[model samples]
Target chain A: MATQDKREDILRAAEKAPLLSPSAQRLLQITSAREHELMEIVAVVKCDAHLTVRVLKIVNSAAFGLLYPISSIDRAVSYLGERMVVGIALNDCAAHLFDKQLDGYESERGSLWRHDLQAAIASREVAQRARVEINPDLAFTAGLLHDLGKALISDYLRGTCAGLLAEIEQNQVADYLEGERHLIGIDHTEAGSALARNWKLAEVLQMAIAHHHNPGAAPPEHRPLVYAVHLGDIIAMMGGCGTGADTLRYPLDQGYGAFFDLGGEDLAAIMLDVQEEFAKIDTSLAETKEN
Target chain B: MSNIIIGIGDLGASKGQDDILKTFALGSCVAVILLDPKQRAAGMVHIALPEAKINPAKAQERPGYFADTGIPALLREMKKLGCQPNARGLMVKLAGGAKVMDPNDTFNIGKRNILAAKKALWAFGLGPVAEDVGGNFSRTVAISLATGDVILSSPGRPNWKL
Candidate 1:
């Protein structure tokens, strides 16, 4: 297909992308706010009894191994915390996109989700340890959705994986994003940004999806969050949880140092934490999927 | 054939001839494939870092996550499979350790990991018989115990035996 045609196809698909669940929409709206109360989050979960049940189920699942089962939705929210709540809601609402196979990238069915999960955890870790006052929960949300654009563009990228890698290696293109644009006239970031817009994600999240690979381009206020996701994404790839071919093709903006004052040791520690969190979350979520 | 997946920071050895030890998403990480041709036992360690000194506690918890500790951990696991990793009888093949983006690599971890794996192996009087390392892409590698075959695969690339 011509590049223009492929671009049109991806855009149309993004335009037709399914809307986020009402509960997820509300959750994002509440969490993305600069000053939202925990009760607000609890109220949102309570509105959807089924979501509350699922949340409690996940918290009580072997993933957490809590001593006693928590019967209250508020308790579940408090225990699993913000990231876990957001993750469960997103996974339940967007299973079609999250669960689809990325054949173009030669990635398995669950690889994209796993990669996002790791990035989210790493991003949260970065935010917690960042030099600035970036919101860790927001960082986790942005990280979780950073590579969502890949699902939208994966089909368009089928059979072009080797070519993309070669072009990237030869430096014929700047990076994977450029390779995507060169081939299809559209990149995963753009595709995902469009989806984020459709979902009415927060301005910070939309900016993150748009410029995760280039945090230097984000607005001054949101730049640190984008940097957090960028570092988180790299950390995930380094941890060997990439979605496939495009795993680590994007370059790191060393400029991130201005936002985060981390060293090799800090990152190594964060990776250890991410790995443990991922194993538990993935096992719990995988069990949920199986059940 | 049963595919035994060795995850990041974890290693497993199998004496079952039909078992294949496999690891995936090897970006900036290294996979050390060991085959004891004599005992028909094989193991692979997915090494994620060059040194355990970054976090000694983590290295102690998951030795397979760092090259310095991973090599010895993999050898110990292989030993449990009833195989001796002697210099003459063991075949070492290395794959992965690709630089994943960033020209000004702050960590330059891929290079460090490659060297660390080699140094660790050399400490045991072993060297790789075959290797396909240092690139700008992720890889999924598998080694069969039944045939001691090392198959390396990447997205959009033809699968080849190393």
Candidate 2:
């Protein structure tokens, strides 16, 4: 198939991809609202029994290391706070979106899920370490969904263009993202942004996902968030978290460090923290699965 | 048979004939494998950075995170496994210093890692007898202790001996 035809096919498929559950959509709406109150988030979460259970389980999980088990939505919200509560709810609702083998990207089943989770964790850490004014939860969400396009585009690429992408990567002709553009008339970044927009994700998040690989290209208003997610992606790869064929194929914006006033030590420290956080979550999730 | 996974900033050595030392998803990171067929011992280190001087504290905490310290440390560990370091007895192989990003990337970490690894190995009068380094792909490298066979695999590519 021609690159243009393949691109159009993939974008059309992404547009019709399964939407997030109604509860997850509501959580996103409440969390992204400008003047949301704690009660509003609590009410939204309480509307769904499964979401409520997942949130409570996460708050009481060993990962959080809470002293006492929290049994109620109100207590879970109060203890974990509104942003964290909503983040956990969203994570639970969207878990299935990434729980698959992405053969086009050479990612095993659940690898993309782990990668997104690590990126989410690292995004929050980067926000704190960079001392940026962006909301950490928003950064986490953007990080988690930045690669959503890969899930959409992978199957299409697997059909015929898989060999082309491999050749580009193997021969050092182009980075993976660029190779996508060269062979498919589009890249995951653009495809992901489209999906984010379709889901009614916040504009900032859409922009962050679109420009994560090149934060400098993001609109000035959203650059800080984009930078946060970009750095988080790099840190996650360095820590040997979930990775695929394109794991290290993206370039780091060299100017980002100076733009954020970050030094190597700060990055190194953030990586250590991300590792610790990922380990805790992994252990907790593993235990959850076993039970 | 058992397989040992070497994470970034980690080093592992195995003397069991059935043990396979492997590291996965190496990008701008180098995996140095040393095997002594005579002793049935193999060691691998996943080095993430070129030098440790920038972060001595980190190097001390995780010597395998930097090439400067990791290469020497892995060699010492191999020696401890009753393997001779001389070229005649030990087979050295290198993989996974791939510049997977754009060609114009400023950091050029993959090239720097290879340089650092080469320098470190040369200091010990050792060098890779076989190598599959530098490109735009992530790699998984594994070495069999029993056969001293090194296998390298990348996404969308066939596995080949290194």
Candidate 3:
């Protein structure tokens, strides 16, 4: 098939039938590129009580490590800047998009949420190491949203996931991209990139999500962040308590290690640090949920 | 019968025809190889976590578990094998920091493992002559003391040079 037709076919197959809410669509359309745009976005977010509550809670949470409590959107904006506000908004919208159902994957809500957070954190860390000029928040946001398509796929596939798990077991699928492509004709990376485009997200985020699963194949500029998220996902999955069918042992990419100038010693050290930090993050998240 | 398995949370050294270090299923786990060609001595450390600074108690007991602690421990083992830090034939090569789980956001233990090891090595004035890390893949690496050859074996792939 022609490349254009192929894109259409994949886009059509994405299952994004119910478009984003009218307010979200409006928030996405703001292209004034002015300071007032930030106010507009904040205003839209404030109108939704559920999203507002989540935003406030997250802004006040230790993740941001604010010195003083932030009770209002304007304060959060003043403290965190417009980019962080946008990120929180996007994060909130994305989380609300998925249902809590496991879709036979057996991953707990905490496990999934933790996985996303850790990967984003790890991606930002890698960006720092790589000295990539990309925004860490952008990388984090991309990392957080990278696996969203998997949730959609799981929801859509529902009971039929048994076959997917069987294939993973037989082939030892290293990443979800293979399974997504095998069963659904399109993988999560592509699905996520489409979602980003549909939401009118920034180009960097779109690039990161589309190529995160296979960073080596991404365009030159986005490769480092993409690679970071790719590795981050693996770390999160491994650290997670119960990975269920997602626990296939895939081989390490020879180029990926070299890309970061990491020799074996470096690789070993990074694992230790991430694991230790993950324990802390896991604990904090647990406490947050409990409260 | 003598594979000299490098058990979890452990380090091993071998020389001449008597050296073997083997580890299994390293995911978000790190395996480090320190070699001294002149003395024909080689050592391997397979450890989890980065350093004691994150958790001092764990660092004290599992010094071989963090890169900061573990690299020193591996160097000590290499020294026990008569390989000095400034020894002429000393070189380092590394492997095994495959992302075991979580495929999205970038909090990668494997990548972090690779990074911490590098920092520790720099502090010790050692550099990797070779390495492989950071992916959704697992790895098995072996270093031969006699020939100073490192062999990396991975799933769905044949054994080859490190």
Against the true structure, whose DockQ is highest? 1
The TM-score leader among the candidates is 1
lDDT of 3 at A28: 41
Docking class of 3: incorrect
TM-score of chain B of each: 0.93, 0.94, 0.89
TM-score of 3: 0.54
**Model 2 misplaced stretches (Cα beyond 4 Å):** A1-5, A33-47, A59-87, A129-132, A159-162, A165-174, A238-243, A254-258, B49-80, B84-89, B100-126
> What 10-residue stretch in candidate 3 chain A is worst by lDDT?
A240-249
Ranking by lDDT: 1, 2, 3
Q: After superposition, how far is residue A77 of candidate 1 from its true place, in Å?
A: 0.7
lDDT of 3 at A111: 44
**lDDT (tens digit, per residue) of candidate 3 on A114-179:** 556667666655555664455555566666666665554455444544566556657755445576
User: On TM-score, who's better, 1 or 3?
Assistant: 1
**Shift in Å, residue A237, candidate 2:** 3.9
Give a tens-digit lDDT track for model 1, residues B54-114: 7799888889988889999888887777776454477899999887666675645777788
Clashes of 3: 42
Which residue pairs come into collision in candidate 1?
A: none
Task: Give one digit per residue, the lDDT tens place, for model 3 in B1-162.
Answer: 256777546788877575566775566667888877777878888866666576668778778777889888888877778887553467888887666444442436667778888898888788898888776555667776556788876434357878
